[model samples]
Each structure stands twice: as C-alpha cells, then as structure tokens.
Target: MERKQTAELTNLVMVYDDNGNVLVEEKVGSNYRGLIFPGGHVEPGEAFVDSAIREIQEETGLNIKNVKLCGVKNWVEFDGSRYIVFLYKTNKFSGELTSSDEGRVFWMPLEKLRKAENKLWHMDQMLELSCGNTYSELYFNRNDSAIKPILK
Candidate 1:
C-alpha cells in the first residue's frame, strides 16, 4: 500500500555575516555537512513571520529586528510527502551566535559555497536573491530535498 500525501511547512533561516555571506555549519550526530540556517517546523496556526523570528532566536541566539519574506518553496515527491518552505531574510540582528543543536556556525564566502562540504543545495539562488534585494518563492519536485540556500 502507498502512503497518502501530506503537506507540511518549514520555516527556514539564512544567517549572513556583516559582509553578507552565508553561515555554514558542521553536521551534528552525523558525518555529513551542509550549510546551516536557523530554522525549523512551523506550528499549526502559527504565523510565518512569528515562526521565523522564534526559530531564529531559538536556533541562533539572535533577535532579528527586521524580518522579510524572501521565498516560498514547494516540493512533491514519489513518497507522498509534500514539503513547503517559507523563507525569510533579515540583515539586522542582535546578540552573538552561539553553539546550537544544529551545529557550529561559521561564515563562508558566498561566491564559492557550492564546493563546500555540507553545502546547502539552494545557496546559489539565495545569494543571488540577496543581491537583487528581492524575495522569491521557489517550487520543486522531490528528487532530493533541502531548503538551505547557498551561493554557487
């Protein structure tokens, strides 16, 4: 028997350095690495903006002053699971970043992130949008799924 399709929303965060570079992290409890962002699942009836702010603060220890929606990505796959992501960008934050459950955080050059191990798959697109100063909604069909946006 096949599983029924279910839709879910994930709040994704991309933290950048003062120079506007993406922060990458080492994988916790696994050898695999990928670009790390401070984000997680959105609770039911939970607003996206609130979720983004809460997730960021919880994961990164930073309180974002200005949060903006930059993208929304939707994915459907053979497994009967559908994933939707609400993307937000914030350039202003307070407090220093600390170690978290996700992993250690470090700033990586946006221009050459694709080659980085544990590199988030969509980084390139996110960096581009960051440059353009626009928020975007991206759609995907599951081949493999990841929401982190890293630069190429």
Candidate 2:
C-alpha cells in the first residue's frame, strides 16, 4: 500500500507533578505504539491553546490550567508531508487521571522515561528544547527508522 502523507497540526503536553514525575500515556492500535504525552489535533476554529487543555482533559481527565507554551516541533514524514506539533508543559493542574480511548495513562519518573526502551520518538530532543524558560521552534526530518534535526 502507498503511504499517505499530509500536513498536520497537533499538540503535546508534558504534565509534571510537584515531585518531578511526569505523566505519560501508552498509545495503542497504531504505528506509534509507546509512551507519549497526552495531546491531539486542534479542531478547526479552536484556539491552539484551548486544544491543548481540552485534549489533556479528554485523554487524562485532568483539568489543566496555566500551561506555558514550551516550543514547537516540525518534521517531515517519510512520505514527505510536514507535521508540526506545538508543545506545552504545566505542573499546575488538578483532578484524578482517567483512562481514555487513546491509551492507558499514568505518571512516570522523568529519568525512567529517559531510558532507552521507554523513550518515545523525539522525546529527548523535545525535553532538551524545554529546558530553558523560553519559546522556540525545532525542525526535524522524520521517518519510520529515525528523526533527525533539520539544522538550517
């Protein structure tokens, strides 16, 4: 079958706790099967920021607020279409985590997630970009086997 590629806009939130643990979800029934932060597409006419909050609430049942826009990640899929994801992070939120149709949700230590087996696609790079209290954009070229930065 031919791979279908298209331009897409998405969001990914990195929710953290007072103890420094981060919430991650294990995605199911897709090519991207692994631990990933909760996030989804921005509906047409919906604000990007609003989409982030709504996605977290729907996927994790957490009423998140006061989230800071960390950065943006841009990549070209193997089939050549571009995919861009706006990243947000927040330690300020409430409500118990709930399971969603997307996957199982839970908290995991940051270090543990850094381990080889648990790492999601481009996660380490995303975390590094979030280290500073500033906003920026990251560009990458991605395929089934690798995700490399587009430096230039």
Candidate 3:
C-alpha cells in the first residue's frame, strides 16, 4: 500500500498593474525555466501571509507592506498528493524592483497572458476565476500533463 501526501504551497501577492497586468519572474533553477511567480514551499510554523511576503521579497526585492487574501486554489491528485495555493493581492508597496537569484522580472498583461500560445501552469485558471468579485475558492484536477483544468 502507498501513503498519500499533501503539499502546502504559498504564492505571493502577485501585484498587478491598474489594468490588471501580472508580473511573472523568470525562475532561476536547474528545472524551473522561463517565467514564473515568486513563490516557494511554505515553511513550518510560518503563516501563509508571511510566507507570501517573504517570497515576494526574495524574488522581486519589493516590500509588500500591505496585502490581503484574494482567493484560494486546491488541487487533488490521483495519488492524493494535494496542493493548495493562497491567492493574495496588493495595491501598495515600497522598495525598488530588483532581480533576484530566482529570475528576471517583467510585467505581463493578465488578459494577454491568458491568450498566450504557451499556456501557464494551473494557476492561470485559478487566477482567471479569482479575477471575479464573487469567487473565493477554486477546485479542480489536472488533465493529463498539460495545464488544462478539469474543474471539480
């Protein structure tokens, strides 16, 4: 028999422009290539909000002194390795936007990003759903290996 595991994930307060453009960091890692958000695994005894702020600072060099929970995303795999993403938003911040060891940073129009040929990971759907004012959580499963969502 095999045991199931649930991974605790944390995403940052992905600041967007007034027009709803999102900034994606170019992940710097052996496996994490191309553009990605500034995030990482949640540390033990760390609050989700604190983790998000820390990650954003580490990746973007921005001080998000204020933020709020926008939504949540949950994923359950056949193996039962669950993943949860905490959606946060921030309209105010300080510090200069500098690059970290993670990746080069740039802004991407959220709508344009949605229409990109190279699809983003699962978060794209969650982001799309969260963009609405009437959403709080989104649940779904992965379709094959692609980023497509099989809503639950």
Candidate 4:
C-alpha cells in the first residue's frame, strides 16, 4: 500500500499588540471569507517560519520577528491528501499597517474580536491553537455534511 502525502501547506500568524489587540485581515474575495490572521501558503523550498514572516509582510505590511510556533491545524481531503496549517504568534513587529488585495488589515481588541459575528468558521479554535492554549486542531469531514474541529 502506498502512503498518502500532504498536498497543501499554509500558515496562520497571530500578531498582537501590547494593548490587548490583535491584527486581523477582513478577507473579501475568497470562499474562506471573513476576519482572519495574516498568512498564506508556503512556497516550495521555503522555510516555514520564513513563509509566515513573508506572508505577514505581504498581507499586513508588518515586519514580524521572533515568531513563536504555537500549534497546527490539519485535515485529510476526500482525495486522501492532507492539508496542514502551521499556527504562529508574535508580539514583535514593526511597520506601518497597510492592507493588500488579500484583505483589509486592521487591529481589533481581543475581546471584541471574540464577539464579532463576521469571523471565519473555527476562528475561535484557531485562536486557541495560535495562543498556545491547544497543541493542535484536527479536522474531521463527516459524510460530506459538516467539518468538525477537534482541539488537542
């Protein structure tokens, strides 16, 4: 029997301020629309952390450093391929905030963001994982009905 392989790799970074706020991107033109962290797919032969940093800069115009790897989210597709998203967090960054074609980037209070209705599905779980409160997020696709997230 042959083993399945990971088909896609991505990252999600939580950039927070000292004032209890987190940087967010209000995604506009994608199926996974809504508020989300600044991140993107990892390029071939590129480092994971480097990808995270590069994505942040591209999406939010922030130069982040000392990013801490908090956790990961992963799931298997119907085609038997897996997708993995590395979660990271960092309070260290410097740049004039700007928005890109990806979304409108802005800062929101953590508490306020928690209560926002426009957040993407599983944003809460992703936040927990990115904050180191959880080790990983395992997604289950059940009978093509709904996607269930299990935090570990």
* Ordered list by TM-score, greatest first: 4, 2, 3, 1
For every model shown, the clashing-pair count is 11, 0, 1, 0
TM, every model: 0.73, 0.82, 0.74, 0.89
The digit string of per-residue lDDT tens for model 4 on 42-142 reads 99999999999999999988999999988777776787777888889999999999999988999999989888988985788787677655546647553
lDDT (Cα) of model 2: 0.83
TM-score, predicted candidate 1 vs. hidden true structure = 0.73
Q: Write model 3 residue lDDT over 92-145, tens digit each, in one string.
A: 767888887667877788877667654435556656654666567766665454
Please list the C-alpha lDDT of all candidates, in the order they appear.
0.67, 0.83, 0.69, 0.85
TM-score of 2: 0.82
Number of the predicted model whose lDDT against the real structure is largest: 4
**Which is superior by TM-score, 1 or 3?**
3
TM-score winner between 2 and 4, please give it. 4
lDDT of 2 by residue, 38-115 (tens): 899988888989999999999999999988888888888787898889999999999989989999999998888877
lDDT of 4: 0.85
lDDT of 1 at 148: 40
Q: How many backbone clashes does candidate 4 have?
A: 0
